[model samples]
Structure formats: C-alpha cells, structure tokens
Target: MTDTALSLNTIQVGANARVGDYLALLKPRVMSLVVFTGFAGLFVAPGTLHPLLAAVAVLCIAIGAGAAGAINMWYDRDIDAIMERTRRRPIPSGLIEPAEALAFGVTLSLFYVMLMGLAVNWTAAGLLALANGFYVFVYTIWLKRRTPQNIVIGGAAGAFPPMIGWAAVSGTVELESIALFLIIFMWTPPHFWALALYRAGDYAAAGVPMLPVVAGPEVTRRQIVFYSAILAPLAMTPVVLGFAGWLYAVIAGLLGLAFIALAVQVWRETGERAARRLFGFSILYLFVLFSALIAEQALAPRFAGLPGTGLGLWG
Candidate 1:
C-alpha cells in the first residue's frame, strides 16, 4: 500500500546478508506457529487430502505468512528503527533494503498463491491471498498507527490459516473451521496486549498507538482480563459444537482456567512481570490447544472404542 517500489536505498552489506537475514525477514519463529495452526486445520477437517497436497498446502501457508511478515517489516521499517525491541530488524538495521524485502514478499506471496491454486485448491489460495492483503493493506498501512484496535482487527489475518487448511481438504469452510478461527481471534487481543503492556515505551516511542500506550496500563489490564474471560468460553465452544472431542474439552477447560488465572494476576499486579508471564503462557496455551486438536483428530481416531485410548468430540 505504501509505495515500497520506490523506497530502495542500497547499503553496504556484502557479507552481512545471508540466508538467515532473508529468513529473519520472513519472521521464522512466527511463521512456524502459523504453519502449525494451518496444518492443524487441515488435519482436523472432516475430509482428507493426499499427503503430498497436504504438505503443499501447509507450505503455501508458511510462505504466505512469511511473505506478509516481510512486507510488514518493510512497511514498518521507520517505526521499527525507532522501537528498541525492533530496532535491529533487517530493514531497520540496514541488513536488507526495504525494496528488496518488498520484492521478496510480493514474489513469495504470488508464487505461493499460484502454487496453491495449481497444486491444492483455489479456495485455500484465495484464503491465503485474503490473509496477506488484510495484514499488509488493512493492518500495516491503515490501522496500526491510526487505532488502538489494530491488533483486534489485524488479528483476523492470523486466524484464517486453519480455515484455509480446512478448505484445502474439505474444499469448503465449515463450522469446525470457524471454531478454529474464533479461538485465535479471541486469543489475539490479550496475547499482544500483554506484550504491549511491558513495551509501552517502545510503542510510544515508535509513535504506534498500542492500547497500553493510548489508554494507559490500567485500562489495558482490564481489557486483557475482559478478553481472556470471553476467550475461555469461546475456546470451549468447539467441544460443545461437536467438532473437537472430550479430551479437547478437558484441556481447553484447564487451559482456559489457567489463562484466566494469569489474566487475574495481570489485572491485580501492576508491573511488567505479570504481563510477561501472561504473554509467555498465552503462546504455550494456543500451541497446546491446537496441538491437542491435531492429536484428537489424527491419532486418537485409530484407538477409538478402546478404553482410555481416545479423546475428542467425535471418534
């Protein structure tokens, strides 16, 4: 959306830019989580895809996520340079030129979408495109600096992978997929807000309007608790909705309780420690919930009807 094409300024980096630099541009750590969630969606969907196609679909999701990350770094380079936490990023650190990152993102985005359409299904490709567009155009360009609700709306971009995964296998977006979507959607606010709570100065310095920076930590803490409460119930809906099994229900309940407990600490305590604890746990919370889904959908079915062998909403 910002004219990245004309922002190329070459810097002296003969040996500084390596494979790792490019990979960092893609945000590999974040990409891994996106790929896992998308794979979980494909796994839990009612139907199946050939293993090769399944792998391709997951690969596309990863590339698309990386592409979006690269574009984000390119667009936010200026603010990134200002923020202490992000000041060393490739674009901001001058490891990779903004134009190069932009080109890499655009090329990867197009390549993955076209590859997905040809190798998997058009539905999944379309979803991938939508996620990329929303992250780049809507979140980065339009909402991030302008609103405190950026994470609330931008979070939707991260929520689409599982739906894309489900579409890859079922060729449709089903209620079960919607459940996965909601889980992430509700989880995003508290997760990012926790980080924002501790990094308020960085956001403020970068001129980004994070909730913590704009509304004050007290308000941010209350908002985090509010979202965490809603998220607990929303997370368990999949179990009641009959897509996930009872094992997921038990785990979801426990994790939700734990999440709320942490949120309460965040609300009661007034410091970075509580917020950091919640932030770390929130990542683990999401990974475990989705991983449980993968286990329930993929592994437990083989041991169905056996005592203590299966856990899920459906056998």
Candidate 2:
C-alpha cells in the first residue's frame, strides 16, 4: 500500500492558514442539508416554537453534523489519501493535522449537544449527539471497513436530522417524524450506491469494501434499482399519512418515478460513463425530491383546520 502519510506531506507548510480551510473541514455542504431538512421537519410539526429557540436548535444540529464530518475525515484520512476523489481534503492533504481535526470535532460535538439541551430540549440534543456518535463510532470506525452494508445501516445518522427537527418543535417524537425520517433513510442507499458505482476504482484502491467494489458493478446496480423501487413510494407516504396534501403527493410521485427510471438505466449501464451520469442525476433527484416536499408543504394552500394553514410555515 502507498504510504498514507505521504499524502499529508504534499501540503505546503502552514497551508490551512486561511479561515476557509477550517470551515471547509466542517463540511458546510453536508451540514446545510442537515439544517434545512431539520428545519422543514420542524415546520411540518403541529405546534409553534419560539423562533429564536428553533433557530438555535437548527444551528446545533448543523454544528453537530459538521463536527461529525470532521471526525469522520480524521478517521478516514488513510483511505481518503488513497482515493482520487478525496486526496485533497484538508486532513488527507496535510493542511490540517488529524489530531487537530479530532479535537475540533469532539469539542464542537460536546458544545452543540450541551447547548442544545440547555436551550431547547433534551430529546433534540440527545438525537444530535447520538447522530455524531453513530457516524463516528458506528459508521466510520466499525462498519465502514468491515461490510458493504455499512452505508445502508449507518445511513441512520443522516436520517436523524428530520427527527431532531420534529423533536425540537414538538418536544417529542411521533408518527409524522418517523415518516420524515423514512424519506431520507430510504433515499440514502440509491444515492450513495450510485456514487459508489462510478467511484468503485477509487474505493477498491483504498481497500474499502464499497458495495460496487465487493459485490461487483452488476450486483451494485441491481441493488440500486431495488432500493429505488422501495424509495419511490416511501417518499410519498407523508401525503398518504395526511401530513401532506395532494400537491406533495403529485410532485413526490413524479420525482420518485423519475428517480426509479434513472436507477433502472443505471442498472443497464456497463461502464464509467454511464455510472457518472447516474451519479450526477442521483444528486439532482434528491434535491428535487426534497425541494418538492418543502414547496408543497410551505407554499400550497391548505384545507380547513388542517395543519397546512398559512399561519405556520409548513401549511
């Protein structure tokens, strides 16, 4: 194996000098999705919140997510150094010491969870902390290197945001929160497996057993289609369960079908070019799917006495 530490040696001395590298270490893109989806869940919940407290809750979730990402980067530094797609990350590229990343992540994790508990409620804060721990201890350290099913099970970390949001608003969990959780949970596999299909070489070189690497491209492709088939209807369950209305149903149905079709095409693909297309489209599919949910919940008119009234954000 190539010397993993050598990748860090390539960084210019004091390379993470700017404020931006530290911010980049926090993985803002991933945090943004966490924060937004959590907020949407809060909005959809059947209650009012102190706006400032709700803001603090979302902020805590975002920081906690970033902290987890930082720690994940620290632990995965070796594999990251080997992967072409991740060779330039701050830790792998030596812009930030792995120890520094670890300390930063731990500190933020403690701070966010504690502050959230004190400022909001214990339930939301607990979920945030649990997600951080699960991502690091369960996904990064254990399952990732051991099994191809890692992402499937470990995806619970990513799906926790909506549950956290719902808890923040309601100070409890409920059926609708589970629905929101299921939406993201089901969406995770196909989305990630699509990327794995395209990036199988990088994963294989790193000695990581991604689905596409361990099972081969054909098996991964079939699994993606199977997961997409399951995901399509689950994405629309919120509407069926009465948390959302017809608008959401229509939009989610259409997007879910499109997602399945794309996965089917990907199943038939034989090489990198096709995998790349599927990978790119999967990101778009997720964004569109979530955006449709937000739009239908926030903008569409509501029926009488239903939670979709204009008084709250989700109506």
Task: State every prediction's TM-score relative to the real structure.
Answer: 0.91, 0.91
Report the CA-based lDDT of candidate 1 relative to the real structure: 0.88
Predicted candidate 2 versus true structure: per-residue lDDT over 28-97, tens digit per residue: 9888778888877777776667778888988999999999999999999999999998898898777888
Model 2 alpha-carbon miss at residue 257, Å = 0.7
* lDDT (10s digit) by residue, model 1, range 1-315: 345534433334423687888999899989888999998888777665777788899999999999999999999999999999889888888778799899999999999999999999999999999999999999999999999999999999999999998898888877878889999999999999999999999999999999999999999999999999999999987677666778888998999999999999999999789999999999999999998877776667543221121112323
Q: Give me the candidate number with maximum lDDT.
A: 1
Tell me how candidate 2 scores on lDDT.
Answer: 0.82
Give stretches of model 1 more than 4 Å off: 1-15, 302-315
- Lowest summed-lDDT stretch of 10 residues in model 2? 303-312
Instruction: Output the lDDT of residue 313, model 1.
Output: 30
On the 0 to 100 scale, the lDDT of residue 177 in model 1 is 84
CA RMSD (A), model 2: 5.7
Would you list the clashing residue pairs of candidate 2?
308-315
TM-score of 1: 0.91
